[model samples]
Target chain A: MDLIESYKEDLRLIRRFGTGFWIVLLLIGLILLPWFAREYWVYVVTLIFIYSIGIQGQNILIGYTGQISFGQAGFLAIGAFTYGHLSLLGSPILVNLFFSGLMAGIFGILVGFPSLRLKGPYLAIVTLGFGIAVYQVFVNSEILSGGRMGLTIQKLQPLFGLSQMTTYYYFNFILVFLFTLLSYNLISSFVGRAFIAIRDNDIAAEAMGVSLTRYKLLSFAISSFYTGVQGGLYALLMGYLEPNMFTFLETITIFVAVIIGGLASVEGSILGAAFVVMVPQVFSNTKAFIPVIYGVTILIILIFEPLGLSGRWMKIRLYLRMWPFR
Target chain B: MPLLEIKDISISFGGIMALSGISLQVQEEKIIAVIGPNGSGKTTLFNCLTGIYHPNEGEIHLNGENILRLSPDAIAELGIARTFQNLRLFMNMNVLDNLLVGRHLHFRKNPLLPMLRIRKEEILHRKIIEEIIDFLDLQAYRKARVADCPYGVQKRVELGRALALEPKLLLLDEPISGLTSEEKEEAAYRINEIRGRFQMTILLVEHDLRIASRLADSMVAFYYGQKIAQGTPEEVQRNPEVIRAYLGDD
Candidate 1:
């Protein structure tokens, strides 16, 4: 049995020595992956990292905060286009990423305003409208999205004798790692408690002195900021920006990742992102059957494990922990 | 000055009056029990005081400052904490987390500090929470999910959450309504102890007149959205209007 002698120990992210050991081992594996894997596999894994960041954001809003959002793609689009324009203006890549996230976060707060009064399907519809509207705006505006021809992003300069792809891969890996830690810290703290409290029971939460307006807007800003950064990374990855690339479908895919991976879990976001990214590649030859496979897989997973893959992972851990008895 | 003062407050839903011209004063460190039948506006009075239901007319003063117009969170920040008639604990969160949420107003708002897991600030908060857990005898159930807890334990958790706020005035709505006889006695003992221990005023809504009268230094009886009687528990119970309200005119 794991015994916590102090409150600090209880609040630790990796409480157990065994868990920390496994995490360190996993980190080593991730560091070695790019070297051993083929170029296609490396590219796929990089896509997973980018989507994982975005999925973490979605999980924060929908999973932890209990706020429904269908406009995640809109924020992603805003981030991508912001990066595209800033990079064209000869700015540093990191600065462009920061500005891209900042711009999207500003829009996120704007979208979060309606959530103060709207909930469930009403909030969903408003966000859906936002996603569609963002796509339309980019398609129609030439200066913004290159008038349907789309914008081209400049390639990154490789550093320290590494290939451009490897550099991009390392950059994303570092970001994803940092963001995951950031989110874990966020959820475990007072801020995360407020968000969960609002989700579980807003009335009691309010009585406990948690401001609904402040935290809801804060959740939006933080969630979208992550998605926005992911969008900037996506722009760098593809070296192109099209209005069509960030359609409602992109939002749905992210949403699916959150649900299928698990709600309110950082590890779930990574698992879900990997699943969504890899599945498409796995069925590249049979692209038409991808949707059918996705639908069937989601239904099957939800039916047996409603909490998603992370929940199953937890059960497996629990079973192993109680193996001799159970 | 009284810790809380409600003056001629009235609220209505469409045409039906939920609370009408109700007024009361709560002194510091005293237990004032409100005894009433169901739908007698006891809960509504609590709601108005907590800023959940805005009174259509009249002013509420907390420490001489007008608070009726403030939101629920604002009222909470002004040293008023409450328990719901129906339990409103965060079911998905663990018992400790539910209490930690009660310490929401006390924690620093700097997002950066928590991101870094600043040991000093976090340890301070955790220390306060640990004390509350000990006081409420919730150590065994600290890590247990609130949903999995029994009803009596859940009720204690609700009370513990309010205590974590460390408010000046506590409004408890049917705190022991659904508990067993043993749990009821235990809750009553805790309620009586809380006034002296926490040094806070309490405004309690209860259907159990016997327990309410025993716990209260003073009692006010409500009947059909109006105060029927107000005095010491003995005097209020002896009043003809209170008797009529409870026992009926026939």
Candidate 2:
């Protein structure tokens, strides 16, 4: 018991102080990443950050509200289109991005309102239809969206005078940090609790005076907004936008990032994003065998650890933490 | 008129009648217990009151407003709160969060205000949250996860959440059915405490006859899907139909 108590004390200390230290350490590493790594690795890190933003939104929707959305990518496209179109019209990058996200939020509210009314599989199908519809809209809207061929997106200039990769690297890094911190705070607040209440048991939550319809719609709106921001960022970073860019496959890719990382965990999103972005490149050398290996590995994870790689790692960590005393 | 009146409420599922022309009036600030055997439609009545299942026939009035047309959440907004027969506490949240969620309907502020860190909204939210935490003596578990808590504490947490709404009328469906005798005593104390301390009106649905007799001001007994007897606790206890239906024989 004494050993357990002592261990708990250490765990508390780690949670309280260790997190700050690690965050600082992570910032330093991220800052230095461009110094040692090539342009390709920098690209990979950017992808991770972008994917993590979507994963964070998914975490809120799935983890707290227990509402599964397969249409986050569609919202992302709306955001991307809003930003890309506005920037092409010579709007400032930040303004374009912000308004793009807001625009996505409007669509989210639109999609969320009806989707929330439906239950389970109905909700999924509706959102799935949304993704397909958006893809089609981008394809058929030739004059505005540039049809299937795509358009070159405007590269956002640095907020400062520096035009170097260093400045852009740091800017993207800040995006990741700000997004993570905001997501964390929102998920830990009263609104977050309401989301969890709805998720855990809606009937009980309603009795406690939780407005299920409003809050369920709110989750969809919020998640869609974040996913929208991610879409805007994707367009800016790629210096391009196209119908082909946002696809049905991208929705599955978002799922892979979140589920493989950890469904409800923020760190899992980051880890999953990094893994998803990096593994494809590393396996590029293997070529033929990579897809088979990837498929089998994903199948194993689904069968053995539906909670994802982070969940498995957590069990190991718990076991290690409980060693000796156990 | 009584504080809450349900008149001729009938709800049917396909061909089966869940509740048929059930009507009851609850006077203000009274401990009214609804007791019945299984499948007597006791929970179905609670569901109708809370707007879970809309009645095919009848009207419910709260404070002279027709609540039958109100959605479950709308009914809740009109100062009515409830607890499920099945322990339906937000099981994954902390004690404080559980109570905080209860104030969702009461805390009416623009969602954007909190995100913007609007000082006034934050202050009001914090004040409510603190008040609820203090009321429940849940300050200790404010940061603890709900999944780790025991069943009894979870029950109390659910009660705390309902109390957070500051409802004029509380509908507790089987608040003490699954509790131990010790828990039943505790539950009875809490119910009395709310009545005495908060001066809140309560309608309890319980299986424990002894608990009912001790806590209730009046008792309403149901057989099948209709109310067989309702009066002062002593009057209802002595009612022959209640005795035959519940007390077996004397």
Candidate 3:
């Protein structure tokens, strides 16, 4: 049996030293992966890291805050374009990334205004409209987004005598790590509780002193910020920006990641991102059947593992902990 | 000055008046039971006071401040906490988290501090929550999700949530409506202990007259959106209109 000696122990993210050791070992493996793996696999893993950041953002809005958003691609485009434009203007890489997230977060607040009075499908439609509008604007605005021709970004200056690819990989790895840590901290606090409370029962949440307007907008802003950062990373990785890149299909892919990863979980986001990224690679030879495979996998997960892969992992861990007994 | 003063408060839905010109005064540290038949606007008054519904006319003063203009959360911050007729506990959260949510207002609002795992403030709040858990005798279910809890235990968790706010005025709508006799007795005893231990002013809406009159310092009776009687429990029980409201006129 688990015994929590204090509230601090109860609040710990990694409760046991064994878990911490394993996590550290896993992180070390991830850090050294680029040296041993082929460049193609390294590239795929980098894309997974970027998508993981965005998926965590979606999880916060849909999973933790109970807000349905289908316009995450809009925020992604905003981040990508912001990063591209800022980098072209000779801004520092860090500053460009920060502005990318900040710009998307500002628009997130704008989308959140409609959510004050709307819920469920109505809110989803509004966000979907937002995603389409963003795509159209980028496609039409020649000066802003290069108008269908797309923008190209220069590679980063290699750091610590590492190869350019490894540098980019490390940049993404550090960011995903920091963002995951931040999400974990945010989820365990009073703000996180307030978000859950609003999700479960909004009226009671208001009565309990949680301002609906403030927290709802805050959820949107934070979620979009994460997606925006991912967009910046994506732009850096691809070295190209096109309006068609941030399509409605991309938003749905991110949503599927949240569902398959498990809602309100950090590890779920990472696992979900890896699953989505790897599945397409697995079916690369028969690209036409990718969608069908995804559908079947999702159906199976929903039917048998409703809590998703993370939940299933947890159950397996519990069973092993109670081995030799049914 | 009275702790809470309701002056000619009236609310209407379409054409139906839920409450009309209902006025009353509640002094500090007193239990005032509002005993009324169903559809008599007892819950309506609680909603208006908590700022869930905007009254078309009249004023509500808490600690001598006009509260009609404040939003529900603003009123909550002004030290008014309530429990719903139907339990509104965060169903997915554990009991400990539910009580911690009650202390939402008390926790600092800096998003960055908690994100860094700042334990000083959280530990302080947890101490208060532990005391509430002890008071409510919810140790066994402390980590259990609110949805998994038994009905009677859920009721105590609801009460514990309200108490966690440490409000000056506590509004309880039907605190013991659905419970076994033994649970009811335990709840009544706890309700009495709440007033004394917390030194809080309670505005309770209970249908059981025996428990209501036993625990209340005074009683108010409502009928058809108007106050029919207001006085000592025995005095309100003796009022002819209150008698007619409960039983058919003969």
Candidate 4:
């Protein structure tokens, strides 16, 4: 009983002050990382932030709304291509990225209109088909993608006189921060409550005055906006665009990331994004082992820790607070 | 105008008629108890009113405005809320969140602005939910997840969630059917208090005749998807058809 009371005190302290301190510490580390870390590691971290944005959107839709979407990569491709097309026409990068997200949101609404009516496997199939169809069509269309050879973006001047990589990294960091704050605000508010309500019981939610069509579409559009922004950033970072870049496998990887990170949690998305992005790199020498490793890791997480890596992280914190006590 | 008028509503699924040309007129601030055996179409009537199932041929007017064409949420926005026979209180969420979800209609429609801050609207809505919790005496279980709560508490939470919507008309399907005798009495008291305190019309469907008899201002009895009797509770209970339906023609 005494241990339990002490543990509660520890938890209160963590909740009150420890969390903010850790977040500030993490931010400080990230800020200083680019200056001290290898250039390759900085690039990898940038990619992780971009993917975190996309995964966070997925978490909102899949975790919060209980909607299954396998076509986030399609929106990503749309954003990248939109950026590529507009940038080719001499628009500024910022304007192109903004339009890229806009175009993706429009496409998301288009898909959401028909697909929101589907449930379970049908929804997944429709979204997966959409992802594949977008890739195939873009690859075939000479107007969109130079007929599979792809379009190359010229090296542009870096923002604020920083190196291209540093500028890109900082820009991504700001976006990730803004989106994290936005998602945090959203998940704690009534809108997020509505999403969880719809997810838990649509019939009850509808009877209580939640508009299923409107909220579902809103989730879809906002999620697509996040993925689209990531896509736009990807184009800027890679300085090249191709239909092949946003693959079916990439879509699956993102879905896996959301699940592995823990559904419906912003922290889960970040952890899951980092894990998925880094694992393949770790196994780069043995390409065939990557799929086996991914599958095994997911299975283990599901069987042993249904809440995924973040859930385990939580348990670890609790265990540490209650050390040596049952 | 009657507060709610269901005129000649008929809904059929293939060959089986769920509700057949049933018309009901609900006056403002009245508690009407609908009693029937299982599969007798009491729930179907509530479904039609809430726009879950559209009547094949009928008109539904709430305060003289036709509500038959509206979607469920749109109908809800016009101030009609319901509780299910089987409790459907967002089981994964805590009681507070479930009640907050009931305020979905009161939220701003932009969906973007709320993502920036907690917002004054949420604070205002939270106050409303707090009042509902106080009314329902759910302060003890405010943070308890609905799934973790007992059946009685779950029913209370469901009622509290519906009340949070602040609907002009509340449709309750078997609000106390699964409760213990003590829980039933408490639920009855709350239901009675609700009408006077909230100034809302109520249409309740219950299988418990004794509780219905004591609680309902009026009573409607259903037998085989048809209304056999509707009047003051004593009048409905005295009708031969209602007796035959419940007792099966001894």
What's the TM-score of every candidate structure? 0.98, 0.90, 0.98, 0.95
Model 1 segments more than 4 A misplaced: none
Q: Lowest-scoring 10 consecutive residues by lDDT in candidate 3 chain B?
A: B111-120
DockQ-based class of model 4: medium
* lDDT for residue B168 in candidate 4, whole number 0-100: 97
DockQ for candidate 2: 0.42
* Chain A TM-score, prediction 1: 0.98
User: lDDT per residue, candidate 3, A137-161, as tens digits?
Assistant: 9988998798667899987788999
Compose the digit string of candidate 4's lDDT tens values, residues A1-326.
Answer: 23323322422312446667888899999999888988889889999999999899889989988889999879999998898888888999779878988888888887787655898789988988889899888888889886757888864568887777887788889889998988887887777888898899998888888888988888888888888888888888888988889888889889889999998788999999999889888888988787777788889988999898889898998898789994
Q: What digit string (tens of lDDT, one per residue) describes model 3 on residues B70-156?
A: 999999999999999999999999999999999999987877787798877898999999999999899999989999999999999
User: Best candidate, DockQ-wise?
Assistant: 3
Best-matching candidate per TM-score: 1
Q: Under the 3 Å rule for N, CA and C atoms, how many clashes does model 2 have?
A: 0
In each prediction, how many residue pairs overlap at the backbone (N, C-alpha, C within less than 3 A)?
Answer: 0, 0, 0, 0
Best-matching candidate per lDDT: 3
Clashes of 1: 0
Cα lDDT for residue B90, model 1?
A: 100
lDDT of 1 at B68: 85
Candidate 4 chain B, poorest ten consecutive residues by summed lDDT = B111-120
lDDT (Cα, tens digit) per residue for candidate 4, span B1-250: 7899989889999999998889899999999999987889999999999999999998999999999989889899999999998888899899988888888887776666676563667667777888899988898897788999998899999999899888999999999988899889989999999999999999999988889989898999988889889999999999999889988978
Model 1 per-residue lDDT tens digits across residues A1-326: 77778767877889999899989999999898889988788889999999999999989999999999999899999999999999999899999999999999999999999999999899999989988999899988999997656888997888899888888889999999999999998998899999999999999999999999999999999999999999999999999999999988789889889989999999999999999899889999998886777678789888999889999999998899899877
Selected candidate, larger lDDT, 1 vs 4: 1
Please rank every candidate by lDDT, starting with the best. Answer: 3, 1, 4, 2
